[model samples]
Target: MPRLLTRVKSKMSIFAHRKARGMLDGEYGSVFKGRSLDFEDLRAYIPGDEVRDIDWKASARHGSPLIKRYVAVRRQTVLLITDTGRNMAASSLGGEEKKDVAVMALGVVGYLAQRHGDVVGMVCGDGTASRSWPAKAGEAHLERLLRDVNDGTALTSPRSSIVEQLSYVARNYGQRMLLFVVADEVVPDAGMERLLRRLRAQHEILWLTVRDAQLAGPGVPGSANSGPEDRYDVADTRFLPGRLAASEAVIRAYAAAQEQRDGGREAALRRLGIAHVHAGSSHDVVPAVFTLMERHRRGK
Candidate 1:
């Protein structure tokens, strides 16, 4: 195994150890809810036994009918779509860098989905599909998805539109599913429409945008007075004093603009009978995923 994989395994072992002892059980909750549907039990069959579940060998040995009992299917499939583009690198928040935040958010949601007896799948998007695996349940499957989600290549690519990739995945899946999308809030209206439309038609979609708090609120108390420090031109990487105040104002303006854009997108999605949720630091991530999953459950 690679050194990084060993490190990940070591950390995971610690987490699993803690979980086994019930120390982290309350925080992570229970990943298993009773028995899985994949198991089966054998029993003697009587009249009107299910022909499909007949145990021929047992029936012959006992000179009586035999049947097979199966557990109920307990898992659902989930697909997560993450955008890793140049725009994601923009970090206005002091938290882990934007890319790191995005990856962590994906991991939290993916991990939770797996815990709930759900098969987790991922499509790391960066102009093109970086890696995609069919939804599957179990620790090994979750680990592979995590490895792919954490890879450096997942976030590197030329500017690529999400519309095309969203369409491809939606069209390819024959069954309905729940999809989680992580991306910057500001995307072209046309791109948003195409992507949302495809998801609405075939699956339940949740859109989560990760951005800096400063971008979320520019009118806060100290925010207005600290103005000049925020103004930096990306093109020139040069700072403009006093203008930092104006820069804060511009950031606020852009935020509002994006908000309005998102509002319009929400309305459009609702028209298509799709639900939407907008999450920021105020809600953290676990709650947001729960909210989205609850919404999906209700929709069904």
Candidate 2:
């Protein structure tokens, strides 16, 4: 587990440098602008400075507009909310387990937080049972948190709902936190959407959806196999009848349904002001996370 975390950190280091440069150049956006928790100093108002941050008394005394500058809080909390359901145990097209991809994703975020001096925590569950680690700083604590979740010792049930973890955080974890939710390709349904909305209202939410190639439609270009003889099931391993898989009309309908489901999930997240990225395999996790961060920084 430590070795995997080290590799993920090495890869993320390059991306982190790029992101830091982007933030300084105003290329990324306001994603990291207002997270400070301590007042640093006052300065003459800049054109792009948020008006709400103006120090009224200081401005009056100086006879010019001034802005309150706050130092970036180094001890903020980063929470990894992961789903350990059976679906997440499925294999990806890259031949790596979805669970492994999730761990890699977690490591990328965890390492970044550690570098920023942020306390890292996790809430891992299988719907029926869940385990949570309080926010803590240090590499060793972070490694233990990751190992515990990756080992599946904390997941008490095979059937887990990501919504359950979201609800748990919303109810119990009150501090404003940066939350990274790692889960399988299940789209948000009405119930899940409601839970996510509540959670987003209180925390910064970033979602990573690990894609399952099997969910690709028959007509999808570059899909694993669209051939008539190809056999595939949903990410959850739900089988479609042989006739359905072979029928052109049924294949088209299935593809359309999946598209609609995916679209709805994206729309819901956007409406709730949550950022999300999709990863197709373990190899895609790090890049996808970087992309997600860039988009959020750009306020996309």
Candidate 3:
């Protein structure tokens, strides 16, 4: 496959001109400001910065307020978390493969972390297996991580299990780091809630959910608003009869169930102080990331 990170940066350059690009770095920096240690330097304060971080004596000497930068904040380990399985190989709500969207989203955040002077790593797996890579600096390392996500995910892969990956990190890793998670729509459960509470106590978490293709409606499962009549299921490799999902009542029920699923996930994450966002396709990743970091920085 072509270089995945190259595609990611090109899109970043395009998004850079769109206003949100420049703000991403500052937003990212602000998110970790509270975790900083050992004073490094100072920069002009922005509106949203916490008042406690300002150096009043320094501000008296200088014309404007300056925010203290810290060594720990400048060299954070950003752990990339994702689910690579049959679920990811399926199509997204934007009519593209979920794996492709995941790669893009992961690459975007990884690139941002790299630019912010942080090391990027990954933890991903299916229901039965999990894998991880150490955090390291450089575009080359970030490229390899993105490539792993792109190449490993397939329709024939094992079932997706983000919980198992979280468990893996909880069991082994002790460092407090930022966890940028990319996964498909997940319904909240008691076990999941327990696991998230545990992880939040150890690491900061950000979740991005790739919107699954909508079935049981007029549109195709993966397509945004249009597609063939039938929906395909990867697990059993069976085609869903269009007549079954074509009913109006069936469509309403499916939509309601999906909403509940979304709300459940949102509430669970919020209760644990984790920030979550939704990306329907590649087009949504950039803005979704911006919104995620904003919420994180503002504690919303």
Candidate 4:
């Protein structure tokens, strides 16, 4: 095969595999099927109850067991807010750019929501106020929604606060909504705190940080040592754990300090009753969304 053709084929294969895997896991896009109350399971027939939910064949073998199932309830609206500030556009992570990760994560979450029959909307931009699309369900809506995210990221300039934007979204949404914010881990300004506290009174919020691996830890994944011959290697240059490695314990200690700061901010948010999750460069957005969703679902 021609070299270009071979590369294209390889890329196509990877895409196909990823799409298939996502579908198998019941994650295709943002629309999620709401839970229903109809019973779904069945066990061996039991005693002292209604005779409706029994497995006769299994009961025959065991002589007296039973099974039952319930309807799953429908899902509520899911709004994904992403920070496209310059901080996110640049990456300290060794993999994709932080903004790229944010886009992909939003796409995956939107796709899952589309699949599940839930309305998925987005609020995007670098500042407090962003371009908003009201929550809507369906494949077409998801495509349009993702387009906003992709386009919005390019339009956002460096901004220091997200609070103004968050507050605007909170008012527009009004009712309880599942909110997720994909952004960098930079310290929020005072405005951010005020907006978050205000939103706390009305919305369920989750903050997911789409950060680089170097930010998450101190090393690169799947990369070999750098040498004179590899001067141009992106891998060699991308991982800056050296900033920590060179100082020996000091840098590591500093990293720990930063982590503590990050933790404290996160803890403070939680105290106000917000949920937060960190996404590393290597982490796929789909699974992360599901993990957060499952946690929220189970909690309720």
TM-score of each: 0.61, 0.81, 0.86, 0.62
Judging by TM-score, tell me the better candidate of 1 and 4. 4
Clashes of each: 7, 3, 2, 49
lDDT of each: 0.57, 0.73, 0.86, 0.58
The sequence of per-residue lDDT tens digits that candidate 2 reaches over residues 1-300 is: 246677666766666565554342232223456864689999999898899999999999999999988887657788999987766766565656677788888987887777667788999887676779998888788777777766773223377588878888877988888898998766777888888888877777888887764533342334464554444443344656555676778768767887887898789888878888888776687678777887777666
Candidates sorted by lDDT, descending order?
A: 3, 2, 4, 1
List model 3 lDDT by residue over 226-299, tens digit each. Answer: 53377887645778777767888888999999889988888888888888899988988888998999999878
Model 3 ranges off by over 4 Å: 39-73, 221-228, 235-238
Off by over 4 Å in 4: 1-75, 154-156, 187-194, 213-246, 298-300
* Candidates in descending TM-score order: 3, 2, 4, 1
Task: Identify the runs in model 2 with alpha carbons over 4 angstroms from their true place.
Answer: 10-31, 56-63, 153-157, 215-237, 241-243
Candidate 1 has an lDDT of 0.57
- Cα RMSD of all models vs. native, in order, equals 9.2, 4.2, 4.8, 9.5
Best by lDDT: 3
Distance (Å) between predicted and true CA of 187, model 4?
4.3
- Please state the error at residue 148 of candidate 3 in Å: 0.9
Better of 3 and 4 by lDDT: 3
Per-residue error for 53 in candidate 3, Å, reads 7.4
TM-score of 3: 0.86
Estimate, for each residue in 1-300, the C-alpha lDDT of model 1 and write its tens digit: 543333433444455553445333233232222223355778877788658678788889878877878775667667877765554554534433455556555666666666567788877656645557888876677667655645543223455445655766765776666677776554447666766776676666666666543432332233435333444432234544544445656657767886787787666666665544655532244455445545544552
